[model samples]
Target chain A: MFSYCSDPETLSGLTWLSCYLTTGKHTSLYLSFGTVLLLLAITAPIALVFGFGGASAARSRFVPLSWLGKAYIGIVRGVPDIAFFLFFVIALDQAFEYLRHTIKCPDWDQPIRQGNDFVVCAAAKLPLGDAPQWVHETYGFFLAVLTFSIIFGAFAANVLYGAMQAVPRAQVETAEAYGMTHRQAFWRIMVPQMWVYALPGLSNLWMVLIKATPLLFLLGVEDIVYWARELGGTKTPKFTDYPHGDWRMWYFGALLVFYLLFTKVSEVVLGRIMRRLTHGQATMGGEAQRKAAA
Target chain B: MSCWDTVADYALRSVGIGERLLPRSDFTLCQQVTLIGSGMIWNIYFGTIALLSGFFLATALAMAKAAHSPLLRKPAEWFIFVFRGSPLFIQFFFAYFLFLSLKNVFPVFSPLTSAWAGALVVLFFNTSAYSAEIFYGAMQSIPKGDIEAADAYGMSGWPRFRRIIWPTMLRLAWPAYTNEAIFLFHATALVFFSGFPATQQMGDALYYANYFADKTFNPFIPYPILACYFILLTLTVIKLFGIVNQRLNRHLPQLQRGRIRLRPMLVR
Candidate 1:
């Protein structure tokens, strides 16, 4: 990256360190931080959408729909989420391939599962098996996002369901008294009122989501955890310009600090957002604020 | 193999007792259930021991954080911040490496490299920090009148705390502390995934479940079994904590006693 890095072997001390930090692997490591952020940015809203759908279904008048939604929400509570992360990525991949295999290869007579292997025709493979490297990476990232959405969606559903109930029955009845239908009452009144109650739970869910991002490594994504272990391993002088003993502690320590700051910032921001959301609500927080202003 | 035989062979498999090798090919439902259930032994060990030992430390840390002296309070505050602030995954990795580094300088620290000693220590501290924060919150919420009553009786420091403060704190914090226990049990699954190597193919429930999923290329079965085991374990923790919660709150009038509800905690 620099002219001084032209001869890395001759460099020493600060120069050696600067050149080493600019290596290709280190660049990948730096970019992976963006991957973690992009994941949080993308997954949050999508999970919220899923949560809304699940909560709505669970509250639906129809028995089967409510049962399905309730099951979706309840099943996740019993298990470790890492199991879901490990399970869904592979399961979803196979489900997609199986669908593609049936559609794209109508004449193929082979069973998709031959004992232990999930066999698909060449054309049925995700990214077509011969696609560019970016396609594979994108596919992995997509799987990671979907898995996170599904798991966290259940948690969000639990929170939002509770929040929905917390909204006062009198408020919804007042909307009905004003000649609004049930659906209208829900959209115009309940949804707006529920956010104040949901904010605390949702903020906690956000922190859990941030911490769980590290498990992206288990899903085979070359995330920050992957890179920390990779870049921080011992590199002998015989192979590279800079020789270092095992520095995994330093790399992981940096990651710890990064997460600490991220969560700290998130706590502050979420606290402010909670205050703002509660400003005009018919709750204890809002009541206290009003009294203070008076 | 018969289901009974499979259970006998694999019942203690996680501890390397009966089975030398795990089932390989042509996986059966019986094998999946037995092996995954076997892995629950490790989970139970990690959770129970961590909770038992962490209880005392958590109480002390909570008291320290609530103490008037900055000398006692500052260290407790920072310990809670650092542990609660970072991901446990990073904590396990950092601890494993730190133990490895220490093992080089002092041979006495060598056992800390193994998952049994090292991972247990990490889980103990991690749960202690979480429980300490819960206890601290409960301590702060202890009724002002209760403390005043104790003071009127000439109770000071240790006696007051033992007779008046600690029992009330435990009663208030029981629900949250129960959630922490459940989370800690689930967190045990990450032990093998972290730096601690599962020696001799012996591993926890998720470990065996992952092994089957890899060998069979089927995650649908093994993971559900793991979920079932955990749900049962979670229910058991709730029940045990409820028993203790009853004893603590028994002094109250029957109508005023708070029931133990399993509050869902959002932790990975």
Candidate 2:
């Protein structure tokens, strides 16, 4: 990246370190941190929307809808989430391609599952078979985001369901007494009140989601964990000018420190948010705040 | 081979006792079930041992965190913070490489490089930190009156703590600790997927599940089977923990006892 980087062999001090750190792979590693942040930014709101739908359905008057929502919430409880990550990426991909295959190739019936392989027609391929490398990578990442949303959505659904239930029945009754419809009561009284109850669980889920970004490497997103392993491995003099024996421990250690700082900052911010949300509310926290202000 | 024969050959396969090679092609449901079920041995082994040992360390750490002196409190607080704040996947990777380096200096540390010992150490410390935090919270919430009553009876220091404080702490912490145990068991699935390599194809249920998914290119069958085994394991943990919870709350009336609710803790 600099003039000194041209001859890495001659360099032996902090200058050499600066050049090595600016290499293409390290630049990718730095950008991958942005990928993690982007994932959190994207996945959080989408998961919350899914959770709202699931939570509402779970509390619906219809039995089948309620059962569907309950099953969605319960499905992720016993199973390891990594299993879901692995299963859904492939299951969803196949399901999409199968749908497209049936639509795109009406009469071309060469068994989609041929004993071991899933072969779709060219038109049915996601991003098509000949698409650019970046397209494939984006498709994989899109699949990963969907998987994370589905699993965490179930967890968020459980929290939101409880929060909705905890939003005092009298408040909803009062809304109805004012001649409001059930939907109006739900939107105006119940939905607004549930946030304080839901914040603790939602903040915890956020922390879990942050920690889970490393699993993106398993889904082949080339996230920070992927880059850490790749760049930290030993590179002999035959391969590169900056040869180093296994520095993976140090790299992973750095990643660990990054997570610790991120989580610590999140905890402080969430604590502030909690205090702000609880002000003048009916909970014990609100009672304490009111007393302190008085 | 017959279903019974498949079970016989692969029953002890995860521990490398039987079945020199895994079935290569034309996979049977019987083979998939038997092999994946066989791999549950490692999962059970890791979870049970780590929880058992982590319980004591967690207790010690909790006590230290609640101590008066900063010397005792700071290390305990920081240890819990670091382990609880980071992903277990990263911890496994970092520990594996750390052990590898340590192995070069002293061959006695070589076993720490493998999944069995190395992964267990990471899981052990990880659970200890989490459980310690839970315990410390419970300790803080112990009713002040209980300690005062013990002191009123001339109880102080060790006797007071043993009779009043510890029991209350355990009773209060049992429900959360049960959730922690379930999470730790689910976490054992990440063992092979992380930096630690499974030797001789000996791995946990997720390992065989991944293998079958790779070979057959059908994730539908194997993944669900693994999920079933885990659900059974989780139910068993709940049952056993419920029994202990009953014992912990035995002194109280039935109405006052806390039930062990299976909350979905997504990660440790």
Candidate 3:
């Protein structure tokens, strides 16, 4: 990382610290913050889409579709979400392989689940047995994004469902009176109006999503938690130039502070957005604003 | 072995009571159910202790936050903010390492490094912060008329708080507090998976579920069983809270009393 980094034992104090911080592992640790951000970036919109579908389906005229939507929204209510995280990673992987196994190895004789092992044909394996390291990493990231989207989508669905209902019957009726179809009213009238109501819940979900990023380590992604543990463990002088005792507490403390600051900034920004959205609206917030101005 | 015998041998396995070793080879439905149910003991233990103890701290903190004096309020406000702001997983890891270091200086702190004491402390703080916020909101929303009425009757300080303020706050906060209890219980699953090592293979439901998933390579069964146990636990929390809620709101007419609606705030 630096020209001074070539010399090992002679370095001490800040010089040694500077070189150590610039190491490849530490660089990866720094980049892992981007991994967390990337995850949030990709998952948020997808979760919203999933939530929209679920909310709409729940409100559908068809009984079975409504039941399906309600179940999707209600599932996370009872079960711990970490269980879902663990289950879906394996379950989705297996489902993919099983589907591929039937198509790719049509004539293969042995059962897929032989006792305990799920033995898929090599051709059916996700990312392929011979794929590059990056491919495997990307595949895992993709699955994680899907899982987070699914769980958070349920929460968002609950919020959106409520928000949709809170959009006032008269507003939708006015759209119908103007000769708009039900679907048109839903899109043109209801959806636009629901955001103000949904903002609070959606902001909360965002914070939860931010906090849940550490669970990425459990999902087998080499995220910040993994790096913190790896780099912060006892490092003897024999191992490297920058030797230190167990510093995991400091590392985790830094992670904690990082999350705190991120959430604080998000709260401030979201508060501004909420204020902007509430202005000129008919809700309690707008009413208060009106009273204040007068 | 019959299901009854399996239950006898493994029913209390999670607490390190009956079984010395878990079933390895032929994983029967009976073994999964019994062992997993055994593990629920830990979940219930962590959840109950944390919720009960957290309630008192939360109540005190809520009052402190609502107090006009900065001397009483600032520390309480910061404590709640720090605990509420960070992820509980990071909190567990940070606390474990902190306890480990503290144990080296004070041997009495050794117990705090274990999951039973250490993880429990983290959960205690975490739930306290959340529940305190709920309580504070409820305190703020307490009708001014009620306090004024108490003042008119010459009620001041302690008597007014005990008879007029506290009960109403509890009634107002009950539904949200119930949600917090369920969230705290679900959070108990993260104990073993975090920094605290599960001693002697004894762990909560998710630990055994993870074991089965690892061995069987079939997640379809064990995870759902774990979820079912949690669902039952959730329902039990709701029911108990509902009873208390009914009692608190008993003074109100049936039409005016607020029903406990379960809005699952999925994560803390």
Candidate 4:
């Protein structure tokens, strides 16, 4: 990255450290932080959309729909969420290919799940068999994000459903008296007011999402955890320029610091959002804000 | 081998009382069910032990947080802050490495790396901090009416607290405590993924399921079975917690009650 980095051996102390940090793998590792942030950026809105749908479904008049939504919310409570993360990555991959196989290769006849192998035709493979390595990695990441959004959306749905119910009935009734339909009353009155109630839960969810970014490694996306493990493994002369005995402990330590710092920053930002959202609202937090403002 | 024989030979595999070698080939549905269910025993053991121990520690920490003395409060506050602030994944990694390093400094603590000790210690402190935060919230929110009633009756100091404060805190905190228990149970799955090796392949559900996934290259079967076990376990948790919640709220009238709600928690 710098002209002085031409001879890594010639560099020593700070210069050596600078040149070492500028390596190709190091660049990828640095870029991967952007990947984590990008994941948070992409997944949040999508999860919210899923959560909204789920929350609405949970309150639907129909029995089955409510049951489905309730089941979705209840699913994550038991067992472990990591189990879901591990399971869904594979399950969703196969489901995608199975759908593609049915549509893309009508002539294929062999069972997809025969014995142990999920043998979808090459034509139906996600990212395509002929695609580049980046496509494959991005495809894996996309799936991970989708899986994460789905699982978390269910939990968010539970929170949002409660928040929606917390909206005062009189406000919705007042909107109705203004000649608005149920849908409009919902969109204009309940939805607008529900934010204050949901803010606490949503902020909590945001932290969970931030913490979840490290699990991308388990999904095989080569996030910070992957790079930490890779760069810090027991390096020897045969593998690369730098030789070091198992530095995983140090590498992971740095990663821990990175995560803690990120979480602390998130806490600060979300705390601001809570203060903003709660002002002039009816909850205890809003009352506190009102007094503070006075 | 017949399914019956497979069941007899490997049903208790996770507890190390059954077949030494896991089924490598000709894996059947029954084998997956039996082995994974066996693994649930470990998950329950970790969750139950950690939760029971964490309950007392959490109460103490919560009390310390509410105490007048900084000497009592500072350590408890920092403990809650650090544990609640970090991811359980990193906690697992940090704890394992820290334990491993400790072994170098003192060989007597070598067993700290085992699944039983290592995983339990991590879960204990992790759940303690989480429950401590919950208990603190409950302690703060303890109704003024109840305290006033206690004072009116001339109940003071330890008697006042033992009679009026403790029950109210537990009642208020029960719902959140249930959620913490569920999370702690889920967090047990990280044991195998962390530095602690599941000795003799005596691993949790995920470990066994992942092993099968690696061997079969087909995640369809084993993982879902693991999921089923977890889903069922979660339902049982809800049911159990619900029963306790009912007992906690028994003094109150039905109309003035709640369903014992839970909020989503981050980190562990």
Q: Of the candidates shown, which would achieve the greatest DockQ relative to the real structure?
A: 3
Backbone clash pairs for candidate 3 read: none
Per-residue lDDT of model 2, residues B1-268, tens digit only: 7999999999999999988899999899999999999999999999999999999999999999999999999999999999999999999999999999899889999999999999999999999999999999999999988888898899998998888898999999999999999999999999999999989899999999999998888899999999999999999999999999999999999899999888996485
The true-versus-predicted C-alpha distance at residue A68 of model 1, in Å, is 1.4
Give the residue spans of candidate 3 off by over 4 A: none
lDDT of 2 by residue, A1-294 (tens): 998699999998899999999999899999999999999999999999999999999998899999999998888898889999999988898989989999999998688889878888999999898899999999999999999999899999999999999999999999999999989999999998899999999999999999999999999899999999999999999999899999999999999999999999999999999999999888999999999999
The reply for model 2, stretches above 4 Å from the true place, is none
Q: Score the docking of each candidate (DockQ).
A: 0.75, 0.82, 0.84, 0.56
Give model 3's docking category: high
Best-to-worst order by DockQ is 3, 2, 1, 4
Positional deviation of residue A91's Cα in model 2 after best superposition, in angstroms:
0.8
lDDT of 3 by residue, B109-209 (tens): 99999999999999999999999999999999999999999999999999999999999999999989999999999999999999999999999999999
lDDT of 1 by residue, B37-115 (tens): 9999999999899999999999999999999999999999999888888889989988888898788889999999998
* Better TM-score candidate (2, 4): 2
TM-score per candidate for chain A alone: 0.97, 0.98, 0.97, 0.94
Q: What is the TM-score of each candidate against the true structure?
A: 0.97, 0.99, 0.99, 0.92
Candidate 2: residue B121 Cα off by (Å): 0.3
Model 1, residue B238: C-alpha shift (Å): 1.2
The TM-score of candidate 4 is 0.92
